[model samples]
Target: MSTKRQLAQQLGVVVGFDDPQAALEQYRTPPAVASHLIHLADLNDDLDGRTVVDLGCGTGMLALGGALRGATRVIGVDIDPGPLETARENRRRVGTKTAVSWLRADATQVPLCPDEPVTAVMNPPFGAQTGNEHADRAFLGTAADIADVSYSIHNEGSVDFVEAFAEDNDGTVTAAYQSSFDLPRQFEFHDADSRTIDIELFRIEWA
Candidate 1:
């Protein structure tokens, strides 16, 4: 297991902790998603010395994982300043070899290099709380607009939603992975039950 995975297992770290700010201060990492992200990075064939941008990069899980996996440069962007600050601190603590940078910006409107080839990865909000497909679609559209390839994670039942989003943006699904994510009790709207939900990671390219 990777160091981060081992640490996550030891600490019982899960995605969407009860107190995100406090969890971030504790340097909690999302192990399952991080492992999946590493797999995505390896699948990219072009990952070596490539530029990568991670949107909604919580606690630097994906960003730091990309750095460790030999990405030449990794930029993590998030709207929440608290998580961004935690990611910065974790980057310093790990002393990642690859150049890692953090930016606090709205994921939907951040400026990106349109001419340069880049890979974008993100774990966007599931939109379950508000059932707002527009937000998810907008995120995918923004990603397609800026990057040559994009990998996004969403709820398992959102396959149709993603397909429609890709279609709307003239993009194609290159790959996908379905896996379970353990969300913390505090993050779920349901009672104090273990929040294990299936999620899908999709790799999309411009059509």
Candidate 2:
């Protein structure tokens, strides 16, 4: 098994969104964060030969992580065509043999229905913008419907929300951990060149 830090180094070549949308809260997921989440998921037996879906897979960070770790099939879904273009290019840059399908569609309403075991991975929008509150809920809803297991990143204090939502939907919170997200200044609201945000990672097992 590769070290988590080693995986991060491999993903350092992935590019971020060219024209980020603040409403979507589009920030390039840090390589460390992506590696940590995907590494843990792989350790939990969620990646090998499984059908992996990366919801809101901006620039294919997590999606590529799944491919690199031997997911039999990978689907990268995002609403924006611009990032999908970049993600396709990143797939070539990484040069993984795992097959990846980049689909331009709303991730929260993914157009996928896999018959085999599925693992969904995402660093969804944190919903910091006005009127975008609870954005992660929609993403979770899709995961519960389509995946046997899921790994998601949320704001630091989302344990209660995630637990309740899982219980209500016949899913279990198998694991939870705190992590940091590196956000380089890309939008107008930024007051600094970079900021590190406290975040949480959750692993859910769906019924």
How many residue pairs clash (N, CA or C atoms closer than 3 angstroms) in each of the candidate models, in the order given? 0, 0
**Ten contiguous residues minimizing lDDT sum, candidate 1:** 10-19
How do the residues 56-151 of candidate 1 rate in per-residue lDDT, one tens digit apiece? 676677777677666778888877787777777777766667888898887778777745567787777666544554456667877887777788
TM-score of each: 0.82, 0.98
**Residue by residue across 26-79, what tens digits does model 2's lDDT show?**
888888999999999999999997999999998999999999888999999999
Question: With candidate 1 superimposed using the best TM-score fit, by how many Å does residue 127's alpha carbon deviate from the native?
Answer: 0.3
Candidate with maximal lDDT: 2
- Which candidate has the highest TM-score of all? 2
What are the lDDT figures for the candidates, one per model? 0.68, 0.93
Give the poorly placed runs of model 1, Cα more than 4 Å off. 1-29, 131-134, 187-190
Q: What value does the lDDT take at residue 199 in candidate 2?
A: 98
